[model samples]
Target: MSAQFELPRDGVTRIMAAPPRLNLRRAASYQNDKGPLSSTSSRFNFNHLVFSPPPSPGLPPPLVTRPRKLSNAPRPSRVFRFVFWVASLVAFLYVASLFARRFVGHVPSVMSWAIESQDEYEMVGQDELPDFPTPIAVTDVHGRSKWTVSIPPTHTFPLSVQEYADMCAQCHEVAVHVRELHGESTSKQQARASYYYRDPYFVDVGEAESHGLLPGFSKTSKATGRSLAKPLIGESWDYMVEKPACKTSLTFVLESADGGLGTTLMLLWMAYGLAQKEGRAFFIDDTRWAYGRYTEMFQPPPPADCVPPPRHEMLPCPHGARHLVVSAGTARDTFGPAFTAQFEDVRQDSIERERPLFNLARVGYEALFRINKDDRPYVMERIEELKLKTTHGTNGDAANSTIIGVHVRHGDVHPVEYQYNGAYIPLTIYKERIQQAAVAQHNRAMPESVEPAPAPLVVLASDDPRVFESEEFSGVIRAQERIKLAGKVPVVQPVLDKSVMHPFKEEAVGWEGGFFRVMFWNLGRPSIASKQTQISLAPEATKLRAFIGRAYVMDLAVLGATSDVMVCTISAMGCRLLAVMMGWEKAMVKEQWVNIDGDYSWVAL
Candidate 1:
């Protein structure tokens, strides 16, 4: 622990600068000069004395020695020649320096001296000026002075968008920051600013004269057919920055003493409104803020003392010009026991039976709805007038009665399927109603001598089975006659063809359903309610529609399933009825039919 350590040796040595040596002065003789007089000596004299006396201070210095002229060696004296050469070189250097001072005056030393001694240098025009400065005279296009008022030190007159954005930040931030502060409403605010409502005429100056709406803008084109407004009126400023339209109409107006005061306030208010959300300030008079001078054009003066026409004048009625009657029955007779098998379950209570029986009634009503909504009675007056035979008839015993017609469109409208089960089915119901009405009229015309029953019903099938399926349609005809005969009547049916199809189209086009066409028709009161008219004696042809809970029930059966049970359960039915009533469909229905076993054995009314 106490051991001494030895220091290692280094080969490097420190060097020191030597002091300057002083040279000894020696005397010089002109006769015994060596090589040349020492350059330190001023001169050497050879007139007398062994060593030349130090040159007298008062005596003039020897003239720079002249070059020697010798026969053997005509050479100049080394000292004399050196002195002469030195004098010549010094004079040449002095002349060179004078030339350099004149030519290279921009050298740093000269430049610094020039700056320090500025008074010594003369300045030409503009050379001593500070910088470019604001102009003295300034005015805007309106010939209003822009320089009248001092511009505030902090306020820039025409700020760039970026600068304006920063300036706007004092009131509210721009873009995302604005969005975050204001939330969803930010976009709406931005849209308002971006779509600031300049006159639409101004936006589309080319169409201004043609529009004839703005008299002022139109006047701009009065001098020539071409509108001068197009060159002057432009698009909005907001549209210019973020998204630009074809052109910008923004203008800088010079404020006049009288006019600009109101305009200035309005502009400030507009700018303020653009920034804030909830806050409000003074009302702006936009007229004062108009950007340009405009005169009203040749506007046609309005007609004097105009009077309006009366409301609710009578419109022409198409069908017979008569008040048409449409009626539907719930049950004309419950019928005799011969038709008792047609009844639903007897064990069910009246309330339960009422539902199904009423549904059955609705099926007939549904058919009637189709005819009324779609067919025009006037167009079908001839068809309604044509009578068919009724009852088991011999030649003379035959009774003639008018044919009531019914028609339906099932998916005939193509892409907009007028389906039989939905709103579209009302057209069918109306058709059926007209058919019933015609039958009722015939029965009312029945002679009192013979017992009267409901008028006979006739349905004109528009499409030939050939139009859809020739073979199937042929079979449909055979089946349809049975339907006609079952009710104890012969149908005066039209042959299905283009002409028959025209009636269907006419009926649809002529009848427009609304409160007027579908109004309730008054029939004498039933004896059950009031004995004035016996329900029993009432025209068997009179018709009625069934409604429950204020809504028409759509088809009771689902597609491919024939029995007339509701397609949806009672609860779902309620929901669907609501949906349909809310205009999901024009109409809906609940079908009624004889459910034999599980099969729906049904006949269209």
Candidate 2:
């Protein structure tokens, strides 16, 4: 069917047509005139209605209105178009991000089965401390591992200082062949016999001063100084690889086994000391070390890429073995009066006992660790932030402020971990020592006049955070709480209480790794008393415990590198680490450090 109509304003002819239907029941189908519109709608009616309705003759003409404007687009389809553009934009951003990271010197983020990033497995390191520069958090240890480097026969290299001096005269090519390599000189790169060993046999207190064992007050104790260790740490990359390169190498490794975080650090420290003593290239094989990659957690060993010879040649005992491998398994066998300890001869003499080849180990540890630029500022920034929070008097101003570092041991540390027989010391002991040290520091900073001293700032770190709750620390910033100004002096904690540390309650048994375990295996089996009752985290607890380890690392750095007085128990290896890390001056020169437990001294591991 078809239809035509005339315009309302002008008379016009109109026509209509209808097709014949095969059956009457089909009836007449009709339609209306059409025009372009956003939405199309046609009337379906009987032809009879269109033919009969001329709209009542007398009725006022229906008011004409402009066609309703409409859209042809469907609601669902428009929504779909918007969604596609959004998805495309997101994909573009992701690709651009990948390129941007690489442009900034970052390698593509690696994915691994052993290590996968999970939201719940929070990052333990600070935003500034990348998981890079080596020492991964937690991974298995490599045992009986074969390496690619070839071993050298330098077994006779480290005999004695006299012999070593002669060897250096011949092998190292020093400018002047002095009879004693012990004469005073401030030049750090030059080899000094005292830099390597104190030689308990030939004891001379005055000559020891010339060895440059102490990084001068100019470097370690300067007012604007940022590090207490950088001056102590001296490494000659060229010296290690000059002519013969690695004359010898020390491999500090685990027997394809894991170790406790604290014990492993101490082991590496001892190994580095021995390596420096022998002028051996120090190499760390924390390959399967429980804490991730070696470089991930720490700066690489000096003479950075110097790989060790094959594992088969690495011997356990007899210190000067060409390739000495030191592990907890062989410490007793290897360190048998080799050095760094008071020999049986010194046991009777009080003076000898007091000075047990301290510089020997001091040389080693000083050469052991040096802080990086990224981490150098954590303590400094926090200290400045704290000083701003504090109200320092002129005598106790930040410029001359005595920054005190205190490490309190509790939780799983004290009695069980190291087999300590004495009861834990009173917190009051720390208070008294801190008070005493403050007065001493005040005296050191003040002139002979009678002016009030400035208040001291204390940096407190602990295995247990609850100690901060005691009355002695009331005005301090609690690890887990908001910082509030409460006292004249303020104590700052390494980490918030919960995001990282918690007092270790006696939990399920799971401590089955380390040299102790290797020894237990060698001595038949561990007795019931030897078994550990401490809590062992579940396999998935990696994310939970990682940050706490990082906080511990920062604590050591801040305490040893920045603080003026250190107060901690020497029984724990960690506390002893502070002794060595603080440089010999703190123990010898001014004696600013304090070992709260009167029973223990800064005994070398």
Candidate 3:
């Protein structure tokens, strides 16, 4: 059976999901699962101290020749001096309390992202650094938003099956089987005419619906649709999907080039949260997305039946816009700098400071993200296999081991995705934290018992394939053979184009599907990883990117749903989602979240 994590609507939700509830005592929810009972939590997040001063001594009367000359200026008396000293101490303590978490409070061991020193220097203009992306683009009040258009959630006019079929007659998929592209040999004919990656938006609504002539789809035959893909949750939605009267809708246009699946998901969640709070509609536009159809991987945004106002009626800025269209490019301008600073003045304690953002993030999780239809079964299979592989008891009969979810990201991220540095957390640091967690768990467990400590199983995910191959994680790493995902991360394979990567190409020797092989057609390709969307619309690259996207979602879902604890670098968007998925109680309160890069904080607009 597939892992069932359906969040209960109407004042209900399950664990590992929106019930991302507020607290927990143990790491894993399962009782039979045993490896650790307690983890290192901020049990004492901040100190609460009370101070008292000793009684002031009475001024000696006449013993001193104190009144010889009364100065016009008031002399410092014992009471005044004592009050001044007390005031200074209070001010000092106030400042100390602000940074107590980073200093006085117990902090999990932190590791650097192995960032290069040059990255620390502030960002230069786009023209100044032509080869790299700007670290973070500050929005301009007068500038036009990149997402100037908005496409309705429901097709503005339902695209009929016959019309779509007739329209897409030319340049249709020849069906040589895209999975064959992963094969070692590509025949000459296959190269000339075969399916590798379909053109963007090739799989239209009509092609995917495959059904009856009603308002909603009804399947009469066992025929599969044009696209083989499906979201982990809902495969199809109904006509007039949302309330007709809805006038305000938040459309998240994909800035497909900016970041990978993780970033897109995070931003979408943020949009969802904002829409809910503002009572606005929300939708996603993947027309220009490098990965092709949004529905190919996940469910469309919840119903907003009304079609969006014309592009002219839409506004880039959020303040006065009737219909809002935002992309990564327009986020800062839309939200403005004030939104980012909201949590800045909040408590520095990890949980409290993060509460405001976490609330919104959790709402996003509960409102939208769900286990898609395709990956549902695999989520459980992966978890069961991982637990079996890392059974913690000495007899090897223990139901499950305390687990740590680790996401290691080192794919070429410098100026674009991550601003802090072009650094990556080392596996050594991850290993140390896992060991530290296990030790802390033991201390919280029955310490008098002579049982040897059990090592927690590690469910690892990383962009670099080399990380999966590391012998350093052999003892803890358990899950085997995942979707090979990589792109510009200290790769060893000597390939032609260094910009984009295909893992299957490296694994399959003598394959000519290298990047530059399509050089003439790859014209105007951006050298930086972030801006490659210009030429990445190609079938091969997009398909590979989709597969890479699958790899990421799988890792995130499995680990988020099942892991006892998450030890990942919070710098990555997926890491934040993993925490959201693990439920706040377990991840935040019980201290199941162990950030290796730094303290816990979410990325803001």
**What Cα-based lDDT does every candidate model obtain?**
0.25, 0.47, 0.50
Supply the TM-score for candidate 3: 0.51
Over 4 Å off, model 2? 1-247, 254-260, 304-307, 338-357, 370-380, 383-399, 415-422, 477-540, 543-545
How many pairs of residues collide in each model?
Answer: 35, 25, 11
Task: Name the top lDDT candidate.
Answer: 3
TM-score of each: 0.16, 0.47, 0.51
Ranking by lDDT: 3, 2, 1
The superposed Cα distance between candidate 3 and the true structure at residue 151, in angstroms, equals 14
lDDT value for model 1: 0.25
Q: Give the best candidate by TM-score.
A: 3
**Tens digit of lDDT per residue, candidate 1, span 380-413?**
3422223223344323334553333222222222
Ten contiguous residues with the weakest lDDT in model 1: 310-319
Clashes of 1: 35
Q: Compared with the true structure, what per-residue lDDT tens digits does model 3 show for residues 395-428?
A: 4534344777777766543213244465556568
Rate residue 44 of model 1 by lDDT: 47
Give the root-mean-square deviation of each candidate in angstroms: 34.3, 29.8, 41.1
